[model samples]
Target: MLDNPQLTQTVEQLTAVIRLTVPVSEISHVMGPAIAEIMAAIANQGVDIIGPCFSYHYKRPSEIFDFEVGFPISRAITSIGRVKNSNLPVVKVARTIYHGGYDGLAKAWGEFCAWIETKSLNPQESLWECYLVGPESGPDASKWQTELNRPLND
Candidate 1:
């Protein structure tokens, strides 16, 4: 289950990502290679990653999801291969943490959306999820944690 949502400000982030429009079912398949490539490219460029990976969704899920899978960098770097450089705007957001496996993310998102509706908040189309702990941390899905952030209109 997710905790109650809270409004917070996030720092602007410099990231390296591979953008794609993929069906929800194929997100894992697409993201896996993209993440590997981006991470490897960043390493090759001698760039340091400052945070866990994230997925920035540009549109709500339907038959397809328009998103970018990437990592935050310590400094801006040149793009390499399919890995392009981008920035996440520093803005006010509704935040919530999901403590579970990826399978439970949809439920968490639904609950967060309901909370937003109840508060009469205007959410932007874009949202991002930071993977605080995941496979790299361990095989225990129950121990994973992800932070979801939805930008709110001023």
Candidate 2:
């Protein structure tokens, strides 16, 4: 019964957040390491309500993203302070909800981007991430609710 939920593109003013991240052009190879580092840190520090975090790229100089990975902050994100201090504008984003585990996240991302194309949306060069929901709240990916966001039609 689970299928793609309707998506919406809107402007958002997110609250301040802290995170530690490394940029790797190869998303697939790097995703495992990123999750591992965050999980390891969570194991030691305990998860906190750090809010949603995203990585972005843009087609233009304006603040916008083409794709994003959403992760609910489970630990204190003190590492992102340096970035926020830069006073940068966040990429404009489009959001959709999905039901499944993170293993299929890449596929979900592909679908989202495809949807963007069909809907006449233009992807920015900037990538973005969103924390629609967390698997921690559910036992399995089938029961997980994830929110995927992409920067488009800006």
Candidate 3:
């Protein structure tokens, strides 16, 4: 489900975001509005999105997890409602590209984490996924591309 797993550095990004802590079952419901609100705010402010949308997970999965859905912006801007300015730190990560629907993401993450363990890599709880291609691109779930990034311990 994932390809070319490797250790890599994520470029630091300035973003506009909306953050929340939600159960695994509620992620889709929460993220959809949060993403739309962020995007609309950015558009209203006339800022250009510098990169794809990212969902940063601040805790390992359990009954609930902290997550932020946002887009990289060219420059920091004023906060709008729940949308706020944030920064993505430059960090080493175990990264891989998953080509499938979002539903299979847990399997991809499991495989990536196993790969990290095999390499004896120490990982942090924080992780992020960049959606490269999504529903906006097409309806084919098989073609959706997501970059899964697990941060490494410093």
The alpha-carbon lDDT assigned to residue 134 of candidate 1 equals: 93
Residue 29, model 2: Cα distance from true site in angstroms: 12
Candidate 3 lDDT: 0.90
| Predicted candidate 1 versus true structure: per-residue lDDT over 61-126, tens digit per residue | 668899888999987778777889987889899999999999999989999988998999999989
Enumerate residue pairs that collide in model 1.
none
Model 3 weakest lDDT span, ten residues long:
59-68
- Measured with C-alpha atoms, the lDDT of residue 138 in candidate 3 is 92
Candidate 2 lDDT, 16-124, residue by residue in tens? 2223333434555655555555445444445453455444433321232233233344333344312221111455566677677767766777787777778787766
Model 1 Cα displacement at 100 (Å)?
0.6
lDDT of predicted model 1: 0.90
Per-residue lDDT value at 126 in model 2: 50
In model 2, which runs have C-alpha deviations exceeding 4 angstroms? 1-92
Query: How many residue-pair clashes does candidate 2 contain?
Result: 20
Look at candidate 3 and tell me the lDDT of residue 130.
96
